[model samples]
Target: MESKGILTKLYSFLYIRGFKVWTSYRTQVALTILSWVLPVFTYYFVGTSLGNSLVERIGVKDYTSFFVIGLAFQGYVSSIITTVSGRIRNEQLYGTIEYYVLSRSGVTSFLFYSAIWGFAVNTINAFIIMSVGLGLGIKYDINWLSSIIISVLLILSTLGLSFLSAAFTMVIKQGNPISLFFSTFTTLLGGVVFPVTAMPIPLTYLSYALPLTWALQGLRGSFLDGEGIVQEGGIILVLLVFNVILIPIGVLAYKYAFRKAREKGTLSEY
Candidate 1:
């Protein structure tokens, strides 16, 4: 009962902190929504201009739908990566790193909870983009159940990546090159704007190594092709493997980095 009470208080504190940060910047929130929505519109126009050729080449009926969904998933990926890395920097800058280190919740838990706001914002932006796509007459035959399952797996995989990012932040005490590299690499090669098959042979093979590639493929298979989890079994299996492998590795790396930072007396340093 005592442990439960502490856990509840920790969650409540984190929730309120996230809510306050979100509401404190109403203009930034509005602009962020606009930023996400405007790209869907631009893609709609560009996809239309490409006509049915992209459809024939990609095997999806509507290029706009394909592009939008890929971009939406990428948005979530980017958010998790950036938020996990940035949270440590923010705490350092605010001189609150010591508070977190001293907290009963522990540093890892604190960093994860601090990213709640970013995850929520990204989710809202994804929904807005999807809604705008539907409003623009981009049809989807989404398998909601399968999509949800894949989404959960994607989040777990992203959590692993975020943990790795957190580890980097703990050690480096600076900007997140990992987030930047993965964001750009996945956007370009993970079939965000185009199918990976369209890339050269070497790039095609390289894309398969990325978690986002399997994620986007699974999502597109579910949403665009209306495939169930069973139908997308191969992609699902790969993603599950990624989660199983990456999560433990990420956690160990983060703990090692945290220990190193403390040993170096750099936890509170920016």
Candidate 2:
């Protein structure tokens, strides 16, 4: 095959090829879609039970829309940080890590693109969650341009951490403490399911350090209140700063880890 054809096949397999296998199971599809919706109600009822106080305290118009946005976008952050590491783990188990790590596209590009399917699946989940919120009469005043910009900023910021997670996987070939720590802390501190103000003061400071906290705030403002880029300028700047600091460190760590792993001849160890 020509180089162009080869590249096309590689991307085809990376992107939609797994869809056929996944959809082959009818029950899995139904259950997966249900899983996306069930959580919306879970949080909805839970938030409603707490009443308007929580909503007011959080500065959101209502708890339903607030929690809905948080629940929906949290999936993207999780997917970003975990997908590449999960791909590496699977490849290691299959004894195929060496092939991709040593391939012409190299480990960085191969592992990064390998995560496209996971992001696509998260998009479906986000859409379903938003639809459920709408069905429940949760209103939104979306600012499309700001929403897109914030979403992209969120993804890029999280991508840095994901790169670091991949590097940890390459080196350890097993449990990943780096991703684990961030995942745990992000849920508690990043204000994914709750307002950061609910946490103690010190913890709130830590929450401010997380990219997800800023992303969720900016997203909720744009998606629920129609706040535009000018209104979201501070958030955009914070996310940009995070990207600037994290991406370079992550890239360096990942490249270093990959080089060391290859030198140690343990790229496929698992």
In model 2, state the lDDT of residue 263: 94
- The number of the candidate with the highest TM-score is 1
lDDT per residue, candidate 2, 27-91, as tens digits? 99999899779988998888778888766776655888878898888878787677778888988
Worst 10 residues of 1 by lDDT: 9-18
lDDT of 1 by residue, 162-203 (tens): 888888988887766778877667889888878899889999
- Candidate 2 ranges beyond 4 A from true positions: 1-14
* Cα deviation of 65, candidate 2, in Å: 0.6
Model 2 residue 156 CA deviation (Å) reads 0.9
Instruction: Supply the global lDDT for candidate 1.
Output: 0.82
| TM-score of every candidate | 0.92, 0.92
Q: How many clashes does each candidate structure show, in the order listed?
A: 0, 0
